[model samples]
Target: MPTTAFSAHYSRELDVEQLGWLLSGDRPGDDQATVADLSQWAGWIRTDIRCSSCGKTGAQVVRPSKARGSQAVLRQAHFRFVDHQGGDGHHPFCEFYGNDTGEARQTDSLLNFGSEKSAETRAVRLLVCKGIETGLFNQATIRAMRQWFFDMKSESRFKVRATPEALAWARSLQRHPSYRRWTFHPAQAEMPAFDWQAAAKFQFTEENLALVELAKTVVHQDAEWKRAGLMAAKHFGQEVFNTAALQPYYEDTLTLCAFVAKNSGISFGKTSPDYYRFQGAPIPLLALCALMLFTSEWEMNTAIAKFARLLASAEPSDLSLGNMIGLNPFHDYAAWRLVILAAEVAERSLKGFDYQAQLTAIESDLRRQHAIWKSAG
Candidate 1:
């Protein structure tokens, strides 16, 4: 049986041994220190710690770079190795050089943050490794997610909206000597240049994972089957139009239409109408909750609560709002509709609804409605 494990390079092993020196900013070579001993140390671990093996400076221990005290201590308790800038500087024959000593196979070790790769690629790899380390997802599943994200890139050119806070953080890192060193590489070195700034902008947290999950889910169009057919779309328009004129119940039809336009990527370009009217928008917050419901029937309440937190904490770029709004009418509609849905679902709970049963019923109705539209047309 091939157990899944992260690779342990010589540099990481050296970092583990020199935890005392790394934390204290002293000389290296405490390879004998135990995890319990490092845990008991009171000082903080700096990002500019030198490698014990190769004397290479700028090795980052897998600690909470932004956290402090006990929280940082807790985070750094494990000795998972992250990539250092440029390279690990180990001799070619060193046991840790490009080594896959972790429980996982050699192939699984391909997603290395330390390698000379693009910042976007490193960010993706970081997410996968963090997901595996934290039990947010399995390695295999995250690998699939990584592949999906790469495959779906459109010439459309997407840029995440950066908040003031994100920008400030990036600025602070740019000013720091350690981070500056890590971000910059000797131009003529064999190492590939990377965007360290971009990597630093994304954290391997639950909120980021949700954002990534949304991107992956939207691109995959997993909900395509539930989308309204041409007839269904026309019929839905007709029904909404009639109801809007006749009753308050039908008033939500316009809102629903608007939601479809915004959340279904209409602003970006042409997209299926079924996205908005029949299947519902895969809004990052809502889609995350919905995915949880589909995967784990018992965790419904937890998923709903998680959705609420994600919605509240979300940044505009986190939801892809920048790309979906302000460029055209589609953008305007999507931006507004997302605001509307957020208000509507803010305090709701999922306890009363059997989501599995509801999904099955909705899918059936969609097929029937689409068929009716086709026949009438």
Candidate 2:
């Protein structure tokens, strides 16, 4: 039987082994690892995720027409992935759905430290994978489920036959040595690129999955943690615009930031000053990783001010340095705001610092900036 799949527009059909390579091939020998049981994995992924391609069903599928709002978090990516196929005049081919990945949530402090649209930044792949039951969904379904990824913002420019473009995009990410060597090429060399559209995939743990659920349940789920994440994204969108576009690094960082803050409770202990210094020395999501300390307004201002100097003086390629010039308005503004805030907070110290005042100033400024941006239109 052809199976009761949700949707398809394949120029061709893929067999089980081919599909296995498609599923785990991104990880060098991972494809070989799955060759024997890939169908089982694919099935699990497919049947478990929300089947958004055809109907309003599965893990997180909602009608395209019914879907609204901008996928603001995903900086350089396309919109078609999250909102249905035709949400913003895009086609409806990939019909994947996502949910929460349940991970841990925060560390407390010495009667000190501190801390809201707590929205769920959708990472459909992780969502579906986390939601999948170990024994229920099948491998075929998993492969089919991933079809939803095609709908996501393509990694590079769009063309009807995107295989080459996608491969090029993957190769261009050569700066990220981790994925370049191990995670991206296997699928293409072995399974064939674009056998399915060059769909970009994302995943998360079950704990993260639950946190997302919590965010949706109440606007006040994890106040300080969520705020920290927003600050980090804003930091990326605004000042650290390394390239003309604040594309590549924002989404993942946001997820990671939010994940770390909320989960630090059981996962790691309270973040200390040492942690901040350790991060200051590197870039890549430094702002987000720093999310642990901004419990109060004062820490935020000091952090931002310190960051500005880092931007002004540090070697630009320092991962954090590159982020200073990335792209994305939200990211830029926050980063800039922090620089300013950090400076102002430092001024409050007997040494020229006031912890309490720092937090207050930041909140006030965040509100003002947010309003300005909203009205700039």
Best by TM-score: 1
Pairs that collide, model 1: 5-104, 10-96, 228-274, 260-276, 262-334
Local distance difference test, candidate 1: 0.28
TM-score of each: 0.18, 0.17
Give per-residue CA lDDT, model 2, range 1-377, as digits (tens). Answer: 01112223322122222233345654333112122344345334344322222333222211111123843221111111223342322123221121111111111110010110011111112122222222122334434323422322323221122122222222222111222122223234244333211112111112122322322221111332333344344333232212212222333334444444453332223443234222211121333233212212225444344333332442222110001101011222222222333222223223222223433454454445545665664
Whole-structure CA lDDT of model 2: 0.26
**Backbone clashes (count) for model 2:** 77
Question: Clash totals for all models, in order?
Answer: 5, 77
